[model samples]
Target: MDFVNEDIDNYAYDHTQIEDDLLWRLELETYDQLEIPQMLTGRIEGRLLKMLAQLVEAKRIIEIGTFGGYSALSMAEALPDSGYLITCEMDPVAIQFAQRFFDESPHGKKIVLKEGPALDTLKTLTGSFDMAFIDADKENYLNYYEALLPLMRPGGLIVVDNVLWGGRVLNPQETSDHAIHRFNHRVKDDHRVEKVMLTIRDGVSLLRKR
Candidate 1:
């Protein structure tokens, strides 16, 4: 069962802004060269990420899961000259592909790729951050949230991708679905933050540490 009706969901995607040519190229290349291409954040969501970073005028950003660095590059393009983005990815192959693209872009210097498990990397990062994006392992969504919350400044935004797990969260049968379901419910009730789960892409839960 789809959490959102088909007609309404289709309308939402239709109304959203489309991606530019460069991002479109990257999206195409990701599908062409990568095995788990679905892991890459597509055009629509990449634009959203860029817009969100612009809105916050974020100086320091963090991203877990740099699958081909699509999302990282998108957000990096939106940041000001002084802004920086620290992105982490556990997969070495994906990191290599992402690094290739990052090296070609003008904003590449702003993006610092950390190749390692995100949980371990997160521990090394201290002090407040302006924004964060989590799109890694689904089962550890809550763990990522807890680890990042303390590092994010009050009112800082945390955009988590794939929370709906391709509408699986509505079915209650899939393991990934249940994990996201639990994580969403937990965030809704968490007193330390305020949140809204938007049906963007699979789903994106936006959180603001209070």
Candidate 2:
């Protein structure tokens, strides 16, 4: 179920700011090579993530997922020369695919791909982050939220993707849908942050730590 009308979504895509040549190439290559190419952040959300990072002036960022590195690269483009981004991914195939693009992008130097379970990788990470992007497996949405919340500095931003789970949260049946529903509620009730769910894409929830 599309939260945004198909035509409207395409219109927005058409009207939105364009990405660089490298990102365009990456998007095409991902669609060509990957089984689940939809996982790539695409133009709209990728630009949004870049804008959010820039808005926050995020020198330090962490990402829970690194599918094809599209989102990771998007955020990294917002960083300055001294900026740093650590993205965690457990899939070897995805890691390899994303690494190639990262190595090619000028902003790629800002990104460090951590290969392992995101939960475990988070444990080894240190220092407060200015922003975070969570786009990993749905089952661990809440868990990732819980784990990453403490790592976020006060007033830091946390952008969570796919909260709507293709609109399944309205009448959740699958375990992934239920997990996202629970995550939405959990964030809604949490007092440590201020949250707003946007209808963009599959549904993006922006959380500001207070």
Q: What is the TM-score of each candidate against the true structure?
A: 0.91, 0.98
In the predicted model 1, the residue pairs found to clash are: none
User: How much is the lDDT of residue 120 in candidate 2?
Assistant: 96
> Which lDDT tens digits does candidate 2 get at residues 1-210?
357778998999999999999999999999999769988879999999999999999999999989899999999999999999999999998999999999999999999999999999998877699999999999999888888888999999999999888879999999999999999998899999999999988999999999
* Tens-digit lDDT track of model 1 for 1-210: 235778986786678787666667778999999887888877668889999988888889999999888999999988888889999998888989899888888888999999899999999999589899999988889999999999999889999988878877778786778888999989988999888888776888889888
Residue 32 accuracy (lDDT) in model 1: 96
lDDT of each: 0.87, 0.93
Q: lDDT value for candidate 1?
A: 0.87
Reference-based lDDT, residue 53, model 1: 89
